[model samples]
Target: MSQAADLPAEAPSARVLVDFDRVDLAYDDTGGNAIEDVSLTIREGEFVAVVGPSGCGKSTFMKLVSGLRPPSEGTVIVDGREVSGPIKIVGMAFQAPTLLPWRTAMDNLMLPLEIVEPYRSNLKQNRAEYEARARGLLKTVGLEGNEDKFPWQLSGGMQQRASICRALIHEPKLLLLDEPFGALDAFTREELWCVLRDLWMEKRFTVILVTHDLREATFLADTVYVMSRRPGRILVRKSIELPRPRDLEITYEERFTDIVLELREHIGRIRKA
Candidate 1:
């Protein structure tokens, strides 16, 4: 509900947060690019959503940003630094919760803190402080009392909350979510949407979410990008200027539907192409 400043009014020249300049990606033995000549810029603290057909390189884009795969040509830069390999400043979560079954919810949330940075080096000495932070995040996400339960004890939605808490435990600068709510039922998905919105509002971390849901993009992103079919390239760049602190009721508004329908039409055209 609080208003955080949106991305800068003008695009950054050298200070761009994330940039893909004529980026092309292909496997060594592949005959063509999975993503081709794609160029885009994401400013610091921006929430950008990418939508496209299956196998349209949405996942490939995530891999590229996380530095799991290097571009076959051109460049990718994040935080004014060239992406060379797996970036430590990035945290990721996907559709599946992927929580280790044996780990309790709080333990699941603490995984990143135990593995990353100053916390990792001081985990033994700072265990209590880190645990309190984890508990606080869980409470914020409505998972306060469930921290001691194992992943199997939680419902799909709760498990996903744990997964997101895990991703943010170390407080990375960039959050990469690849359809993190895709597997949940519609009601649960919407509930988590508010949870995610609140989290992003509180932290203001840059987010790159790859989702097939146009409504989700409209609800959460500052900008929505549509990609062409395989050998994917950005085909549309639409900005959503909807008033912030968006409620589920807003999805019923004409303005919201207009944006969703426009994005829908774009996706339909891509599917036919």
Candidate 2:
């Protein structure tokens, strides 16, 4: 794996934004935990990826971080506060675009502002300003001309782009992505990876991406964490020391391949356990 010394010397010192302290989650009284003994800290503006075999509670980690599910044991802290319910500082994009068919791409992007606080209250009063921001986000993700198009009118890649824009339109401090590119073809998925990479480079938002693709995790995250099966626990925390502003070409490099294979070995062991 690449070493931290490879990172730029000018990297900013970041405060811890999300902390899971010996967290465990049990969905039912059966007493079987979905995730157990998970402890990690994600610094503000850090991009972290969680990967494991199917049913390893990767998505459960996202739920805990976003406050959708409270842990049965331990605590989850976000932005200096313990998370008790759905948090306001997080934005999420999932495998499915989940865009409303009736709404144009621009309207879909504006949904967060229409529902989330502060913006929701002032939406009518500042509709023009909000729309301009939405348009800019769409343009940033290569959806400039497609803003007027409905979800059905856009291609799969385009719709995913719109989904990401919607997640960012409100500019949440933490962004959660759950296999956001899993549904796309290989080429399209790689393309969206670059789109997401550029967006993260520009905004530097804290991101927790739950993915099964080791290569995807290696390419996008500052750190990649591997989890155990069932009662998921952090097995490894691999810091990616590849210098920043990385392009897709770096994915083919020897170090990148080594990192991916190392993550793969962890997953293989967990699956065979």
Best by TM-score: 2
After TM-score superposition, what is the CA distance of residue 53 in candidate 1 from its true location, in Å? Answer: 0.8
Worst 10 residues of 2 by lDDT: 1-10
lDDT of 2 by residue, 55-74 (tens): 98999899999999989999
* Alpha carbon RMSD to native, model 2: 2.0
Record all residue pairs in model 2 with backbone atoms less than 3 Å apart, i.e. clashing. none
lDDT measured at residue 6 in model 1 versus the true structure, 0 to 100: 40
Give the clashing pairs for model 1. Answer: none
User: Ten residues in a row with the worst lDDT in model 1?
Assistant: 1-10
For candidate 1, the per-residue lDDT at 100 reads 93
Q: Which regions of candidate 2 deviate over 4 angstroms?
A: 1-11
Clashes of each: 0, 0
